[model samples]
Target: MRVLVIGTSGYVGSAVAQRLSAAGHQVVALIRPDRGKRARRYEWRIGDLTDPDSLTAAVTGDIDAVIHAGTPTGDATVDATAVAALTSRLRGTGRTFVYTSGVWVLGATGTATADENSPVNPIPIVGCRPDIESQVLDFAGVGIRTAVIRPGIVHGHGGGIPALLVDLARKHGAPVVVANASVRWPMVHVDDLAALFGVVIEQAPAGTIWHGVSENAVPVRELAIAAGQAAGVGGEPQVWPLSQAQAELGASFADALALDQSVSGHAARDRLGWRTEHPDAVPDLREGSYR
Candidate 1:
């Protein structure tokens, strides 16, 4: 398969690109002009998701699949626009389009575990995703193989959110955790999530959703403690008031941190035989990849 991977230079997209290429698929990476120098065996096409012409160039007929791992910023509409554009380009191509969503869309799962069929109560930060998810899933009605991957907190290899937590732990005696100590958040290793992307593009049926979670959930305080320990600080976390966190990191990010969620990716595991290589996120945070 010839796969065009959006956000190739980003944390998740880079791993997706590498995984696809290693699996013997022809990879086309859509990256910014400044990042083009890092392009190697996989073809690199200079483009931005917000630019229509660039999107057109990147989504050519030769591409068999699209793994959209791009993260949306404050401009919530950009992602929806990009998805619309990609949808138009892929309309009747019978190609696979795997869009990345997040578990935050499910919001605080509380005591229950959310599956693919879980009702969404997205946080204010990712409030715009449900519409986009609906749009992408609707592509199947047009004869396109589209799947939405809702990943948990993506962490691994000293990058993603864990890195930020580690930095915070190093600077302060303990890391700052949004909300109270009991709030739980779902998490996934980057490598494992990337592998699931590969599985979805390769075998998942159209109009479906998959959660990229390895461990079901981890408490925020526990995660902060692991981060603190990793950064040579004691395993104690300072609670950041929601208002304060929102003021500092914006409402969306802070709200995301405050969500208490537990989710299952058992559908992917049972349906596709998806095996998670790294199941324990805390050990990874303390001494494995994050260190």
Candidate 2:
């Protein structure tokens, strides 16, 4: 299968590209040709989003599936334009089109573990994801195999979100919140999340929604302590209140930190048969990779 994966350079993309390659799939990673020194399995192409013609060469000929892993920045129009253009270019091709969405879209789920079928309550940063997903999923009805992968806090070697917690734990002089941390959040290793992509490309039906997560819900404060221990700051885990955490980390972060966003991945595991090799998020923190 000739698989075309966009943005195969970053943390999640790198891991996913590697896994797809190792699994014996022919991968063509849309990359800047200038990055010749970096090791990768896919063919690099120089293309601009504004000029769809540039990507015509990349998308044309014989391409089986397109995994849109490219992440856009602050501008909504730019991201929407890229999605629109790419969708237009690949329409009616009967190829798999996978989009990467995040768990933040589910927002605060209180204590109950929600699934792919659960309602989405997005945060400020990713609020537009659902609308974008709607456009992609619409293609499924047109003979295109469209799907979305919603991942949780994707922690891995290069210091992602877990690093933020470890930093807060190590730098904060005040007592951290370790009791009644009430927020429930889901987590997954980068590799485990990458495995889900293969599942989507090969097995998922068109318009399918998958939770690219392993553990659905873990207490917020407990996750912080695990981060503290991993950051080499273990001393009878401090039990600070939400107000206290707010005072130390600021209210915006405090609010986000306090979110109990737990969602179930039973659907993904049942369908993809994914097993997380690095199940513990805190241990990844202690390895100091977060540093």
TM-scores vs. true structure, each candidate: 0.94, 0.85
Candidate 2 segments whose C-alpha is farther than 4 A from its true place: 32-41, 48-57, 173-180, 236-255, 286-291
Q: Give the TM-score of candidate 2.
A: 0.85
How far out, in Å, is residue 81 in model 1? 2.5
Model 1 local distance difference test score: 0.84
* Model 1: how far residue 63 lies from native, Å: 0.8
Tens-place lDDT per residue, model 1, 183-241, is 88788999899899999998999999999998898887878888988888985689878
Q: Give the clashing residue pairs of candidate 1, or none.
A: none
Q: Which stretches of candidate 1 lie over 4 Å from their true place?
A: 34-41, 73-76
Task: Kindly state the number of residue pairs that clash in model 1.
Answer: 0
For model 2, how does the per-residue alpha-carbon lDDT over 105-215 read when each residue is reduced to its tens digit?
788887577888888887766768888878888888877889998888778784566767677677774225532555566888888888889878988888989987777
Error of 1 at 267 (Å): 0.5
Alpha-carbon deviation at 82 in model 1, angstroms? 1.5
- Report, for every candidate in turn, its global Cα lDDT versus the true structure: 0.84, 0.73
